[model samples]
Target: MTAVPEEQPAWRQRAVERSTRAAKLRAEQRVQRFLDAAQELIAEKRTTDFTVQEVVDRSKQSLRSFYQHFDGKHELLLALFEDALSKSAAEIRETAGSQSDPLQALRLAVEMLFEQSLSNPGVERPLFSDFALQLLVKHPAQVATAHLPLHQVFTELVEQAEDAGVIPAGKPRRQASILMQTVMFVAQGNGVPAGSHAAAVSAEEVWQFCLGGLSGVPVRN
Candidate 1:
């Protein structure tokens, strides 16, 4: 007959559970510290060229600690990219929700995205150009997963607008996706130098164009 293992005493079991929870909390704190450090470096340098050792040094954590949480710099960047997009989505959702009209809400969301790109070019530019672009080329699936939150919010607003007859009766999800892509393309180009061959487009103009496209009405300046 196989022998059965003895169960731990109640007090010992409780102590072990508490210890496990504490360890998990500490691990999470360590990861946050590393992430914060990397984000700070990216903002300060206006680029993603910082090294893993730099992150370790900034976080005041050992290389071993960083490796314990992340495999490499690419993994860390991916984590930061996902976190940033998720937070952006939340902010857009909250801001858009404040408006009673669905069309106005969608417009506000688009304006907010453009404003962020213009106002925070240092951070947003590098993130999209250096990290997001590369991720799109190499790991498209990951990009889609990270972008889902923002896309979902846009889809909800589009659906609301369609139901209200503010927009044409068509594919709300497709419309939302197009709106997102158009806004992103414009926002990404906002960093172009003033003297570049590309003509500068104002945020209001972009919004008007989008509104016209959805309503199937010509927008008059």
Candidate 2:
């Protein structure tokens, strides 16, 4: 009947929609796999030394799927760098918020952030590598956007500490940014760097030693 044809078209459209959703879901999963594989390789090697074929194999996804998700390894590395920076910055804010005092919170925030460098970035890697750094630097606005959350936390804490007479009055955000950058580079990847010197130096030890220079006066624990 004519009525049956109209109903059949609606049914077909629904089926097509369902099929499209399933395909999209599969593509996203494949993308995640590729990202994980790339992260593993980059962390261990400190460079994009691995090949696209290797990442595709590790992801258990086909080369076509890999290309669909990323144009190439450079794009994948950029995603990872942006992701890691934003993720770590958010964590620092959360951790720093839990401290009793602004100074203490700042220290905790710094120590926790310092863990990010623990990925063992030797001279070869040196944080995002020159190639990746150059790419990220080109997108300064994006980089700053990713860092804004952590910067805001620092700015707020600096204001609080200054108002409470905990720290000297100065450019709170600028000072905070400098401090955060210093601590972030202290460790290698995302935790405290491991070594004889690092082993002997506890996070608290580092904090106490630098307190005088940081506070310009003795700070109580």
Candidate 3:
């Protein structure tokens, strides 16, 4: 019988590549744990007062591992903002998928996003609130980079709707940006004056108005 040949070089290279990928995934998971822990802490206290050490303890991860993923607490907050935006976008996409009409899907996405902000108390105030947004304004690079994923999702949905003839041809990205900015204020309750008799418009109403403008459909009262 012929002797079996030793493992091929390409095979060894592939094995090393797989090992590297596994290590990368594990590192990401650890980083995500820290963000999740931070969110939980904010929820518990309804504020961003917790220390990095407390986040590390909540994550059950070593300080060394935390440093490996993020430079400092501020960087970690940037990561948290990015992660929350991405998660919110994903959920909106999932809910919007149930609709057959592309225009309705776009509206559904907006409704779902607003509902998510309302469902999580800390979410609205921590990341998307006007007060929080002002703090991030100085870090334009970080904010722009972190917000790109959510922007992409919103822009894509609008483009698809227009392409499907669900809405008239217009500047999809511009529309998406305007819609996103407007919804944040609406969700943060900024539009309603405190102790006023004015009725704040619902997310559905906002969506209908947007649809009316884009598709020339009449807005329902």
Candidate lDDT values, in order: 0.83, 0.68, 0.75
Instruction: Give the alpha carbon lDDT tens digit for every residue of 1-221 in model 2.
Output: 56554456878989999999999998777777887887777667766778999898888888997887788877776666667667766777788787878888877776666555444433222246434446656766656666776778777877877888787788887877777666554543223456633353456655664455567776566
Pairwise TM-score winner, candidates 2 and 3? 3
Report, for all candidates in order, the number of backbone clashes. 0, 11, 0
Worst 10 residues of 1 by lDDT: 119-128
Work out the TM-score per prediction. 0.85, 0.65, 0.78
Leading candidate by lDDT:
1
Model 1, 2-107: lDDT tens digits are 9999999999999999999999999999999999898889878877889999999999999999999998988898888888778888999999999999989999
What order do you get sorting by lDDT, best first? Answer: 1, 3, 2
lDDT of 3 by residue, 1-221 (tens): 99998877998999999999999999888987998898788778776777889999999988898888888877877776777777777777777777778877888887766665543446533253522565467677877777677677789889989899778889988888887767765666735676764676677876776677777778765
Regions more than 4 Å wrong, model 3:
1-8, 122-131, 164-166, 190-200, 215-221
Once superposed on the true structure, which residue ranges of model 2 sit more than 4 Å away at CA? 1-27, 43-47, 119-139, 186-221
- What's the distance in Å from true for residue 147, model 2? 2.5
lDDT for position 44 in model 1:
88
